[model samples]
Target: MLTTILFNPEIEHYDFGPGHAFRGERFASFRRMYQETLAHNPHFQWASHDESATDEELGLWHTQDYINMLRAASLAEDDEDSSVPEFAALFGCGPKTGPSRQSLSVYVSRDNLNPLTGRLPEGIENAARAIVKNSMLAVDYVLQGKTDKAVGLGGGLHHAKANYGEGFCIYNDVVIAARYAMKAYGLERILILDTDAHAGNGTCEAFYNDPGILFIDVHQTGIYPGTGLIEETGAGKGKGFTVNIPLKSGSGDAEYERIFDEIIFPLAREFRPRLIIRNGGSDPHFADNLTGLGLTLAGFWMIGDKVRRLSDELCRGKCVDLICSGYNPDVLAGAWISLIAGLSGIKVELKEPVPRIAADEPAEIADIIYEVRKVIKPYWKCLG
Candidate 1:
């Protein structure tokens, strides 16, 4: 009956470095903004996740070798280790760019430091455990029937693979959560919807062989980690279950919502999954520096509204939200405020300002949106 939202100061321990886009302050600002917005609200109960994921728990999807490799990298204490090239890459620090080991310690071990604190973040392993375990805690609560739904005030680290990390994501929490539900709760069908600017590459990879997991990714085309293509549907039993809706550069709200209605919604209705997972990334907002896809505050509210409605109809209101990836402070704070407001059933003005894409971009976006829907229409009855 309650929608439990998970936000703890320690989640910020997953910080990359000072200049990196995935900084801890985003969580801090969002917490400040979220608390102020949802203050005195009766529909939402805010909470913290106490469980840190053990290696065994992480082994639900990640390999023991990958886990051990990161633990070794975390020991470096600085990012300058050239001896282990593969290990450096695991921490998002390759030969060309990344932090020195000191940058690795930038936000860790700071239970006494600023917000998004860690009791004592040893490094990426500590932060990864916090993110994944905290995410699972929310998942566990929803699956156990203690709460109907939960939203994590955490990044959607969907870019991490089963055996490696990529794109600032060390572990794929979306995949882990879905797998967790299936194995622990014995639920067969799970739906993962990723709306990040980048494709849910890692997530799609992990579940490509399994029919029980339906993965949907809607992202800007040709971006970093560009693997989600129109033809890359699921393989084997999972064939056609993996849906990739690649929006053209600068796609706007109308374009995005159209694809969702024609493609995503209809498929979801047909799938009738036992649980719904949303990787709520705001990087598509016009103001986000990473990508050009256009999403305003109203648009974000629409996404949350649509997803919430679908969960209520298809899954008895069971959903886990891993809020992720909006770069601008205002963008992250405002978009989330708008989104959470919708999910909580609160009708009010999200005071954050909305920015639009370039004037000419909307027309181009419309064409791209229509094309994407057409590409998938043959596979899904809802497209018609």
Candidate 2:
């Protein structure tokens, strides 16, 4: 049975404010979709997350200094007259400079703000721990032979770095879970498939030199965090282990499918991973305001099914999904539910058909894919 972990209470504390694209209501919308749609599927098993990670557990993938900084911010009790501006600026909390979307901008809210000192709650650290702990629990279940596939719907914080948070992510839960799987569970050669609209910069950084973890990110080009170029393969021992396919703007379902057929599937066959972790972000949907890529619910379902098939074929059916980013509440909710249903092997009635590829679009994307394969062919065993 598939075990799906939903940290409902943790969702309460993961607020990014009203106008922000990364609002907590997205989770609520997903939960509602599951209840109304996928709950009836017999093959799916839904699990709720009750436990959280301690600092010791978090230390597995994060630095102590960074963790301490988060703690200080959360507690609202200053460390010997530590100024807020000093810590906030260092932690990326000051006025936004990069992207200029009004919907994307969010100031500290009253609920999140510390009343005594007029500062934001230590929510980032708490949310980060919640993400890591929930992911660890899901990993443990899969490793112990409790479930072959699991989904941690609340924690996908991919933008979180080893030292600080960015792009609404804090603590890099996927990395921690991957580390836990390798160190505690004795799994070798873990594969991370990050399909977030934005590049998984933090995850790439975490495993940049680690050869054991195979990282593949298929993101939109020229987006937030400004990384994940096709040439930015892993360094040192991980030279060929990191693979990126940054799709051009407006590249949708056909582009994604071609990448899978030509690159992702073949590479997975070569690497032969023991476990697969999917960074399932649905923000690439055409309706999303944050991204430029145009994908529909059908595209997400197809990708989810493809990942499930890959797990069954390559990793003895061991896979876990960490929900990443998706801003449009309704579309994100629908896409996430579809992914869960698809991964769990449930029969879903299509609300909308997969977007059709124009005659010229596939070739356009294929040209890009061909160029990418040429660049990374040296790393793969038989791509050349």
Candidate 3:
């Protein structure tokens, strides 16, 4: 299977700062690991480009007002203090170094500025746009048949909404890419599978009333930006298209496997999506700094393999993967290698620093599965 891998070193400019939980060095780190390990693999192809997504393309999902917010935040250098704190708050700007009222800037955190120069990184907006550009490029590669599967190393920014950004995400690349597929490619049925440890709240909101997209989010329960509840399915035409499978904190490989087999597989078989988009990273690993989910390397591989099989069966092997999150750099790198290897059908072994944590006997997520199945049963006969 041919896989198109997109990477650009400059994409690291999106980092809030070195000390922030989210760092830009992840792009370079993953590239280094891939070169040392899978560089010689002929099945894998590397592609890099620096084109930022145009305003028109971004307007496919984001509003002009929100787009203006990002541009202002990106270009604000105190050369012209154009920040309106209340307006910025409406656009989902986080608090700055001081209180929100006192700080009239959206991008004013010490972590957001350069410690040496006390200025935001030049062209930070371009870095964010580069992610959108490459992510959309992945969709094009898969749909255009340039490759059966494509990976956007800079995407999966699922937390950005139409008018607001959250979860360290400045733009919702996943939603933008999906919207591009629908509008540009005329795809009616598309499935987005979000395995991020946190709920894809922005993505969920974007498609909550649309039936064309099936969004399934599997996240750790009670995490930050928590909103994906079992009964919180879609509304109107999208009543059952939004599926939230919130696993408990310690759930691992066995639990995830059960979820895919019982819920995801049945729904995909029925929906028969024309394309599959999978996002998230190794944050679910036990060693991750951000979340408490217990997935190990093996579990990551299992999830990738499941996506591979599903894509092969349902979408003619067409899939786009966004390697988007994970805090522990070493563990994140290993888990990504395993995950990609599984998706590409390549054989590779990863040695974990710690032993795998076993899931609770009988898998405590059984109740979650039952509830999700029951909630989505009316829309999918396969579940019944």
Choose the strongest candidate by TM-score. 3
Name the weakest run of 10 consecutive residues (lDDT summed) in model 1. 111-120
Against the reference, the lDDT scores of all candidates come to 0.74, 0.74, 0.82
Q: For candidate 2, give the lDDT of residue 198.
A: 88
What TM-score, computed on C-alpha atoms, does each candidate reach?
A: 0.86, 0.86, 0.90
Model 3 regions more than 4 Å off? 79-122, 355-363
TM-score of 2: 0.86
**Candidate 2: misplaced stretches above 4 Å?**
1-3, 6-8, 77-122, 350-363
Residue 374 error, candidate 3, Å: 0.8
After superposition of all CA atoms, the RMSD between model 2 and the true structure is 6.0
Least lDDT summed over 10 consecutive residues: which range in candidate 2? 96-105
- Output the worst ten-in-a-row residue range by lDDT, candidate 3: 96-105
Candidate with the greatest lDDT versus the true structure = 3
lDDT of 3 by residue, 264-323 (tens): 999999999999999998899988888888888888988989999999999899999998
How close to the true structure is residue 140 of candidate 3, measured as C-alpha lDDT? 94
Ranking by lDDT: 3, 2, 1
True-structure RMSD for candidate 3: 4.3
Model 1 CA lDDT for position 20: 59
